[model samples]
Target: MEQPVHHFSELFEQLGLASDAEAIEAFIQRHAPLPESVALHEASFWSPSQAELLRNALEDDADWAEVVDHLDASLRKP
Candidate 1:
């Protein structure tokens, strides 16, 4: 069976960011429209540990990967 996916709120909480709906939206608004050359894990706004968590989740396809991908997509919008 596939693992259940989580919400962006949970992903934000895991990243040690504010996890409320408003905060999540604010975060996306602030950092989104990522450059094509920069991957989510390579974004300059993340702390080292936060970046590592995202990198690992994507690399390992962890339970968090789905939500992480959602975040990645959100950031890519122009």
Candidate 2:
């Protein structure tokens, strides 16, 4: 079975996403595995507001820079 995701918000926080619409969406898309289209049909089943926020992030480039910086730091771990 797929690993249990206790809370979707955890996904955002783990990715260091800002609590903005675009960032949430990007987080979802980035983490969601292939063959699963990132759509509210699946996402909406959870929380509409959160899902919408994620969708908006997917559409906008709002949090790209910060996320990248965070990623660079994470990658340097020994």
- Using lDDT as the measure, the top candidate is 1
lDDT of 2 by residue, 1-78 (tens): 543423434445644446466775664455443233434323433466545554554457334434433432332333
Model 1 regions lying over 4 Å from their true place: none
lDDT of 1 by residue, 33-65 (tens): 999899899999999999999999999989999
Indicate the residue-level lDDT of 12 in model 2: 52
Q: Which ten residues in a row have the lowest lDDT in candidate 2?
A: 69-78
TM-scores for candidates 1 onward, in order: 0.93, 0.31
Q: How many backbone clashes does candidate 1 have?
A: 0
Pairs in clash, predicted candidate 1: none
Alpha-carbon local distance difference test for all models: 0.94, 0.44
